[model samples]
Target: MKATIERATLLKSLSHVQSVVERRNTIPILSNVLIEASADGAIKLMATDLDLQIVESISAQVEQAGATTISAHTLFDIARKLPEGSQVLLHAAEGKMLIQAGRARFNLSTLPRDDFPVIAEGDLPTSFELPAETLKQIIDKTRFAISTEETRYYLNGIYFHVSDEGQPVLKAAATDGHRLARVTVPRPDGADGMPGIIIPRKCIGELRKLLDEVEGSVAVSLSASKIRFGLGSAILTSKLIDGTFPDYSRVIPTGNDKLLKIDPRSFEEGVDRVATIATEKTRAVKMALDRDKITLSVTSPENGTAAEEVSGAFQGEGFEIGFNARYLLDILGQIDSDLVELHLADAAAPTLIRENDRSPALYVLMPMRV
Candidate 1:
């Protein structure tokens, strides 16, 4: 296979696929990208790590129609370091792939294209399309709460399902026992009968990259075991996690009657300032909500204590709760409104947080002992 592609175009395509290739692999071919050149003036690049696969196509001047596999990272690095606007030529011959750009040249080892594993495109029973911005919003709001612990594998991905409401709505949720984030958006057409699927954490990261700065619509396809996303010129396919997510609805607090309204930015800043004296082990911050003010304080036997008062409106009885400072900050960062509403029942009960904008997104936090 031989083709000539612009440096910028080649780098963009390689950047998208190379990230799917793991740095260490038991199979040599899995470490390389499959490059297929066709006489139709386009080249396809594919990379996979068994669990996730990315395929991208770029326009190129094809001199011959054939296919081969070359080290994905190596080729990406070579293309990235080449002079901007330079034309890159790739030629496969005699068990080696030749790469040339301007005065630079390098020979890379090649694996037979037949050895690369290709994920079969089975019949997808469910398919739909949604605006790219909508998908990005759902992912951004919930991904941070996904569990990194491998033991409870079910919590390692976002749980996606349609709500049981009479009106069609799509919901995405993630939880790690400490905090939970859930977001709901109007369901797109053709997505009514889609089953719940757990999209793995790594897959979400890669999919976000593809949707970054992308407008227009993204096509989604789902099966019982796998999920696929179609971006403009690229495609991502991932295997779904085979576990049941816990009943997240039971954990969300419904009886929290105390309502406290405060400026999110000021509250976040107050927590940050008081948390400076918090112990590194727990990073715990105590919040005391009174009639018209909320006090954020942190006390450590060895580091002393710090406190800051922020003005707020509170109803019902005043209460105090302890929470992880980092976790609280994370939840506050996702709020897009100037005012944040915290619904609380007591010191030990889970607190519900929502922005004033009423975007159908809510966060639940389990209190920590200070």
Candidate 2:
């Protein structure tokens, strides 16, 4: 295989596909990327780690049509160090893959193309297209709540399903039994009959990073076992978690009457100030909501005590609740609105948090015993 590709273009595609290659692999072939240079002036790079895979293509000046396998990280590292605007030439022969850019050149070990495994592309019946901005919003708001605990594997990924309760909309939700975040976008066409799928946490992380540079819409297709996303020049396919996600709807509070409306920036700042005194173990901050003001305080036996006041609009008598400072910041960081609405029931009941925007999104927080 012989092809010449622009350094920037090759580096970008290499960055996309090399992330899927595991740093440590038991099988030698699993560490190498499958590079295929077609006669039609395109170079394809593919990498997989059994459960997840990424394939990306870039235009290249192909002199011969052939395929080869080389280390994903090694090629990316070499391409990344190449001078800007330089052209990269790739040549594979015998058992060595030669990479040349400007005056620098390196020969890397090659592996048999047949040793790489391909995730069977079975029929993915459900297909839809989601705007890149909408998908980014959903992932940004909900992924913070994805649990790290492996015991309940279902909580490790966002649950995506169409909720047609009052209005037909697509929802993405994640919860760690402490806080829950749910975001929505208008239901896309051709996804009404799709089953709920739990996209693994690792897959969501990678997809979110890719979407940072993606615009327009992403092609999404799924089955009971797998999910695929087609970004402009790249495609990602990942296996869905097999376990059943818990009934998350049952925990969302519906009748929280007490309302507290506050400036999100001011509230977040007050929480940060008070949380400085919070213990490292709990990182708990107490929110004492009153008829027009909220007193954020932290009292730790060892660290110290601190308090601050954030004024807001509240109708009910008063309410006091405690939450993890880190979790509060995570949820608050995702809110893009100036006003934040807190619907409260009691100290123990889950409190609902929503933004003051038309775009539908809500968060539920379980109080901590402070």
Candidate that scores best on lDDT = 1
Go through the candidates in order and give the C-alpha RMSD of each one to the true structure.
1.1, 1.2
Error of 1 at 260 (Å): 0.7
lDDT of 2 by residue, 112-212 (tens): 78788888869899999999999998998899999999998989999999878677889899998999999888799999989998999999998998998
lDDT of 1 by residue, 127-233 (tens): 99989999998999999999999999999999999876878899999999999999999998888888898999999999998999478999999987899999999
Candidate lDDT (C-alpha), each: 0.92, 0.90
Error of 2 at 1 (Å): 0.7
> What is candidate 1's local distance difference test score?
0.92
TM-score of 2: 0.97
Clash pairs detected, candidate 2: none
Q: Model 1 reaches what TM-score against the true structure?
A: 0.98
* Residue 172's lDDT in candidate 2: 90
TM-score of each predicted structure versus truth: 0.98, 0.97
